[model samples]
Target: MQQYLFFSRDISWLGFNGRVLQEAANSSAPLFERIKFLSIYSSNLDEFYRVRFPVLMALANVPKPGEEVTDHRGILNEASQLIARQLDEFGRILQEDLLPGLKRHNIHLIYKEPVPGFLTGAVTDYFYTHVLAFLQPLWLRDYSRKFFPENNKLYLLVVLTGADGAEETAIINIPSDALPRFISLPYNGTQYILFLDDVLKLNLANIFKHYTVTGSYSFKITRDAELELQDEYEGDLAEKIENQIEKRDLGLATRFLYEPGAATRTIFNLAQTLGITSSNMVQGGSYHNLKDLSSLPIGTYKELSYQSWPSVSPKDFNTGLSIFDTIKNRDVILHIPYHSYNPVLRFFNEAAIDADTEEIYVTLYRVASDSRIANALISAARNGKKVTVFVELKARFDEANNLKWSKRMKAAGVKIIYSIPGLKVHAKVALVKKKNNNRTEYFGLLATGNFNEGTARFYTDHILFTANPNLVRELEMLFIFLGYRQHADKYPALQFNHLLVAQFNLQQTFLFLIDREMQHAQRGKPAHIIIKLNNLEEKRMITKLYDASNAGVKVQLMVRSICRLIPGVPGMSENITVTRIVDRYLEHGRIFIFHNNGDTELFMGSADWMNRNIYRRIEVCFPVLDATIKQQLMEIVQLQLNDNVQAVQLNQSGENTEVTNNLPPIASQQEIYNYVKALQA
Candidate 1:
């Protein structure tokens, strides 16, 4: 049954976490933003069972025909049956619709079988002052080796039953990483709360004062967060990524979960002492780290969350000048969470304290851990320019904070490369160089995300900035082919007529602009295309946008995450459509548009037509060439195609639906942050 052509990128990332459990079962969101979208769908299913279900259970123990293996047990039994039908539609939208719509807004969450006499004296004074001094029970017959357990935390287990009837087991631990898994009690104003696993299940008889508790449960395990780079037998690739981040907390037990009336012999003796089998345990639902409902204290209902707007910053983009004389006077874009990522960290802190700057370069795939853009490239390598950087030491989960900011930007002398071993520069480009009198001009910046001013306040990225000397000589020939010191076939003057890049010319410039909008929909003229990606998943660019939607070409799309193309599908994608917005920021810009015959050919950066961003990583994209930043990115993609409140649609069986378009509801990230705050008023 493994003939799957697509739709198993972990079941399209659990159908994009069931479109984030349809925005936490959207009952017109806002009720602690549907419990912060069910705590980001239980923190994206606990990092998809800790990093993609242990790489599909280590590719279901290999040994297959020709071994290009993709059926990791049919994508882990269709990602554990689409994560048990999205955790039974996230437990019927959190126990029959958001705990009865947060008790009709008076808010309440006290779960474990009704224990709510105004939260029993503030959960018995928070279990005698902060969870009985960090609980410590052990007894599974004197559990040794310092009682193991410490991945994805939480524990409980118990079972006792002595007095000569026979039975014993113990474990406890759940000091929810030292408290606060939702406490807030004393509420005469009617709010209440609780579940620090029912405050350690009503303080289990003050930590088993010599046994007989009966049947506690809880559970959690997760592990296998896969980070095994020996750095090609290390010579010090940042001490082999700081010794695989200290052996990534002893990685290996992938997913145990439990507490669905647990105790099948305590889930088979804790899955045979945590080596976990029977297809990695699971049972679930007594709330094992519901990704701590992303700090769900439900705070006395600030109109049930999701409101705070602030992030527009473009008073004509001039936070007191010299951002290289305002991108040398023209092309400026910026747009993230509607604008300010402080002009891409003030264009590298004003060209690292510009004294006619000199040479900078940059690439860094991700940043921010005390990064004022890595302290302005370590203050422009201590004011002696000619920098370099690259850095992407495998950026997934920011490889130990980019190997501790690449050994503090290589002890502040700066050069640093460490990336291209099978390419992953993810092009965010930088450039700089100055000293003009006797030559050397360049300036550039280009981005799409990650010069990370803390994920530019919720990721709707788009940088740009330019001095435009032919795009700073094609971004100094892509930092001389990412500093392998030239040899992108010895840079033919880094020719990128107008940049699409990735392994040179993003998939033949996006299949020659979707065959110029399928030759203007076969000469009927005025064809269209739009785009705005985050992921469309590359099936030859979704079968060339389903052959420009069977040559009628009115595409659309907007895809914010893993869309394995399947628009309307009548005659294969009825003139395509797609959607998926998920509000409160994070649409992470990519743009595209193409009605070429109608002179609408715009483009935006940091590519994502996938297939590892167009044939393996070094992405770029470009061409918005500025007619007031292409009419401000076509008015933020026509206000996210007139969002009927946090969009959705994507159908053709990959259901996300929810876009009842009548048109008066527009919530494209609060109407493109009030149309870029009314263009800075």
Candidate 2:
């Protein structure tokens, strides 16, 4: 027996975020893009506090039965230190680089300074007019029940003193949600942007007319976002989820982030009264919610941003034939964000009105707010076609949006299926059945991302349109199982030869594939494995890959975040290499390739090798049978692997090191865009 090593999932995730910060610090990136990376880092940290931090705290409190307790406290401390350093770097980039860069471009962002003398009048006027109506101030002592700091909502704690020297505190909300976080004012032939916090700071005298404002500190409390749902086989799950969404903000506070320079007594008092533990107290910069920096008014300074690459229309879908007819002839694949998403939209729009169409089945995880796909389904139902949509209401943070779409679709005659009792249907597949001249034709759409066109604009994903009956039949079977909405174990055993579905054959088939590669290596034949995913944390799958690595099968992984397997470890994973890329678009597609001696097998789907995906959810991974599409995927992945710029190699300790060599620089996103555009030409 050999002892294996794995990186802590939380720490590995932090390392991924560190890579994002690196992009922010990269002087070569566009100024606005760097600012955007800062915003992304802030947003990612907030979610980690809301979701993962609570788990860490809970784990620290639990004691093992026989063995020593888990050192969750140590892990938490390490994570905290990493976060503090990252935040320091964040401030450095914002103050030292981004702000000065904006200044060079004739834009002034009022950060920690007082309002410019010329702009004071304009700031006060805007505050009294646009910002006054939403202001609600409460005395911290008097409004105990009336005010609990809502999760992640910004507020200023004002320490006030009467004329007699007696002091008290009041909290006023910063209405960034109601208004823009950055207010732009042009003065003295220069563009000036001010944080809403500063505007409120300048106008505090108007709000508290009688008190002498001694101190003010900005702070926000991040609450746990996990929704606890009862496994009730009886009631309305949608209604239950809706209720939970309403209560999400009121969960236990996981982080109490307050601006530095607040008195120790004041910080502790605020924490005590607000139900926040001292452990949750974190001293931060003057401005919290820097994620709002995404909205910084840089105006039309095109030079401050990356040159936009307009999405190209895929040549295969532009033959002027109907989308169904085109897919009926051969399999079609779209590399999204690089390729225009109009064809995907047209796929459903045509199905809604196509007279021969009789039935449609699909699974939706995260639905766009104004989903054209959902609307098309509603229309298809109205046009007398049977439309069944399995809407996963359990998608984190998007539960409310999904539930909203579910209600509208149900009311419009589409048969909407809610989530199973203990399983989330995360498969992104759609089936369209048509009856033409007493012949039945099926068109299936499978994707490595959500069906939401909104996300497709910025998330790099792949969508496959095929008329293969083998894959379509397996997809139909999965949808039928989802319709039951029972516990996964209660469903009948399903046999899928063509599709790898979780909770059934997904994990097993993946293990079997790795085993085949190991066997090939044992026979002294060429063997290799290539995979790309958003996350890879499933232990069994990783161990199997380690087995393959030890057996001389080369493994290459492009994991965007949260990879646990330690690559380049001697005799364990020495043959495995992990590469991470962060660039203009979010890398999101899941691709897996196996070198079966001389024959290569390729797959792309919605599944990531995570515990929840493999054991607790309904996921689908499908094979790429079309030779042309397979070759294209292989070529694109090779471009990514060869990338020197915007790509990093992860070592055994999970640290991201720059991918450097004597080869010429290759930014894969740009190269892939050129590749796809050339194909169009």
Candidate 3:
């Protein structure tokens, strides 16, 4: 192994964001849809700074004894450079490509003068009435005192000069949170839009009343969002978390972005007051927070947006019927966004309303505030059913909401289990028990995504509903473990023959299976493996795959994010190939296939090939017992493998190179959606 080639996962993630930017730059995409992609890219980068950048800073502070920990510094420098390059590209595309294209369609984004006379009154009146109330001006003389501006909030720096040339500067906070960013105006047979910041700039003299505005520019700051959680072992965890969330707003400043052509003195003074060092400042174009463009009301230009494709429910599944009876008959798989997620929601709703249901147990990682699943669980508790919900309160950006829902469920008589002290409960599962003719029956659901209804519309995932007794028994035992009532040794009867349960046997089982393939390869039998997951960051697992590859076992991986392994390396991973697919819907399913000397084994579930999923979280992976479902999964993987349009190969240099095979172009997401739609038709 020639020094094991690797790239920082953070930088690799930026490259993935570059793909979204590519979509925005591609003229073939619908005009408004391309704008939406650009907004998504911007928003995704914001969260990256908030969440991941702080982690890198923390890593830089950790001591590594005699070894130099320079990778963190190098990674941050590379990220800063890459972002500068991409921002330039983004600006050029918007100005040269998208703006001109919009002009051809009779749409204009007015910046400087030559305003339409008819719309001037409307724009001025709207700014005076709506935008004036939110403006709070802070003078530079009052700086170096207590002033806390919200992170990532936009502000306009206004510099004024008196008759004697005495200069003073003040900051005008743009209340984008309180008002719309873009204001549309009526033009002569054409539509025009003015950015709210420009509207303010156009009328700054009226607001100041006394000062002559020499120059004004817009700027924004990003803060390090890393929360410093106190060691909860010494005190109340909830209180500590609350304190940390409060301090997050005033965390260390990470980046200070300003409009181009900002005066040198103004930038230096603003950076000093904001506690921003030279290394943390970035100067950019006129606009900040282009992510807000997603909400721009450019009217119903049908030709400028993607055509709506309604979600199609599976042909065999009925929305108005009992889901338990449907699942009892056979296994049903749901492909979300393309296929309706209502069936999975219905599974919980029907169970809650069903008179025979005795008990309901579920593990929730992330859920929406207005969660239908949570409401159903509350209803089940109200109807005298034993309802147990293991809510993970550690879900990032959702901890407070989860805590609120946990309290609500407990108040509704549902037994609420807080997250395990050390581990996050990430499994998406529900086990329902019912009484039929004096006998107890169980039905379970396993999924690759959360029970969040809002995300289900844009994320592609899989849900398996089954009445298999063996799996149901294991699920029941797992819930007991979550409740902290039983240890691993107490669940001998819950031995898994077809399910891979994390924290007990998942890692070992996967290693055993890989070794089995390796032995078969050595014996000259046909040996192959196919795995699909969101991330592959477990070092041991990657090494095991390398071991298998060295034994002549072929590996095909479809990883969507954070792949730490370098595939296709000579003598080490020559037989391994890794591909990623980025498209309209997020690919979030996890599947594993092994060619075990002709008798293939296929499994699908919530666990990714990450360390957290294998040994830290309670996850479950069940075999595709139904032969038809197994074939369906196989076909899905095959379609992805054959995809020449959206699939990108993860090369040895960690570059996402578009596959250039001579096959006809196939975009898998569209094809899969059409495939399911045709099935319903």
Candidate 4:
């Protein structure tokens, strides 16, 4: 038997981003959509620098005892090279494809070129009026230590000759945070856009009148975003997390991205003065933060972007019947972005005002800024219903928003449970208890994504509404266990037969299911596995999939982000196929299906197959017990597997090879929308 191998998770993630770049480079995509793709790629890379780059740096520099030390530096170099190549393609697509396409539509984006001489006076006057107030220039040599540039904030370093004829350097902060990154200029019948950086470069002489401006280069520093809590078990987790959020921008520098063509000595001096090591210094383009391109003023040129597809209201709930009534009689599933999110909102809103509702329980990993659901929860608490909310403050980059909502809810008489010590409750489940005719009835929602309405419009996910007694009872038990704030081992009575709760029976049940499939394959009965997740990185699960493949159990996987399993490997994973899809909507669901001798078993929830989900967090994956909903979900997965457009196959080397065939094109997102609409019809 040949040995099995796995791809590096980080490198595989970069390859996923490369597929995003492919969308940007595709000529068939709408012009503005292509620009949006470029923005996504840039934003994704910035996050990699902030979050994952630090992990790679730590692994290479500080290895733990007994940990297998591999060539981490080599992996780092490979990542760097891959990003460099992607950035090159990014530049090419912008310059060669997108910019010209914009010009054809009478839009002129002033990129690297100097501001047109005809508009210099207008821009110079506008700059002094609109952009001058936010400028703060400091001499690097005098204030290097005191100047703490915030993470991912843009700055320009200027080389100038002082009045005394001595060479000097000063740093000017780009006020993109305050002012618009892309400024619009008036031109007859044509729209003109300028990067705020170029506006600063053009007007440097006005700000530094005493010094001769020799050159200016744009740069930004990306800091590590990981927050380390000193003690999780002993203190207020919410207060500790709030403190950490305050210090997040001040963490160690991870990358120093600077424009090329700066003098070598000047770069060295700047690094030394700012306490940045040479290894973190990376040569970037003339503009440091292209993520702001997302806001490019594509004024009234709606034709250049994707045509809108109005959200459809599901038929059952739109019939003027109560949402609670619809769920009580049968299980219902809504595919978001295709189906309107009103049902989910109404589920909470009704529970708030319903006379029978006695309690509401929810786990919020990431809450929307102006969440209607959170507002409804507050109302429920105010109306004398027992509302318990588990707000996971450790949801990175969202700690502040979660804290804000948690405080408001607590003030409104809601019982707010902060994150579990040393664990993140990533489950997207909610339970509502009501009294009907003196009998207790429970309604629950198990979803594949967050409860954020804003994200619901762009993330393709599934939310299951069920009144199944078994599932709802198990959900109530899980919430009770969460309220205790103890590890699963401490609460031995908490066992789930209907739902798969991580840190308890989730991993073992999944393994057992895979082994069962292997047994079926050995018996020459029908056997296969179909799983979809945002990421897959757990070694044991991947090994089990390989074992199933060797046992003749066909495996079809839809992993949207980081996938480490090397597919199509002879004698190991030859029977397994991996597909990735990136479209207008983010594929964010986790669905697992196993052919139990042709009577398939399906589950969907928030957990990925990553180690953090399996061992470090309390994730919940529930079985699809209803036959009609199960059939619909199975059909959706089949559509995704059959997708040719917006889908790519992953090879053994983790490259995203395009899926091609002679059959008619089937973009799963569009097809699913049509399928759901027809079902309503």
* lDDT of each candidate versus the true structure: 0.77, 0.92, 0.82, 0.92
lDDT of 1 by residue, 320-340 (tens): 777676667777776786666
Instruction: Please identify model 3 stretches exceeding 4 Å from their true place.
Output: 1-3, 58-70, 111-118, 230-240, 319-321, 485-497
Instruction: Say which prediction, candidate 1 or candidate 2, comes out ahead on lDDT.
Output: 2
Assess candidate 4 and give its TM-score to the true structure.
Answer: 0.98
lDDT of 3: 0.82
For residue 341, model 3's alpha carbon misses the true position, in angstroms, by 1.3
Candidate 4 per-residue lDDT over residues 1-681, each given as its tens digit: 556688998999999999999999988889999999999999999999999999888788877678665778788999999999999999999999899999999899988897988889888987999999999999877884678989999999999999899998999999999999988886888788989998999999998999899999998999999998754456677778888899999999999999988899998888888889998999989997787778998887778888888888899897678899999989999999899999999999999999999999999989999999999999999999999999999999999999999999999999998888778899999999999999999999999999999899999999999999999999999999998764433753777888999988999999999999999999999899999999999989999999999999999999999999999988899999999999899999999999999899999999999999999999999999989889999999999999999999999889999888666999989899899888788
* lDDT by residue (tens digit), candidate 3, 525-605: 999999999888887898889899999999999988778788899988999998988777778998899999888899888
Show pairs that collide, candidate 2.
Answer: none
Lowest-lDDT window of 10 residues in candidate 3?
485-494
Q: Write the per-residue lDDT of candidate 2 for residues 429-505, one digit (tens) a residue.
A: 99998998999888899999999999998999999999999999888888777765453446656799999999889
Q: Give the runs in model 4 whose Cα sits over 4 Å from its true position.
A: 486-489
Model 4: colliding residue pairs: none
lDDT of 4 at 161: 97
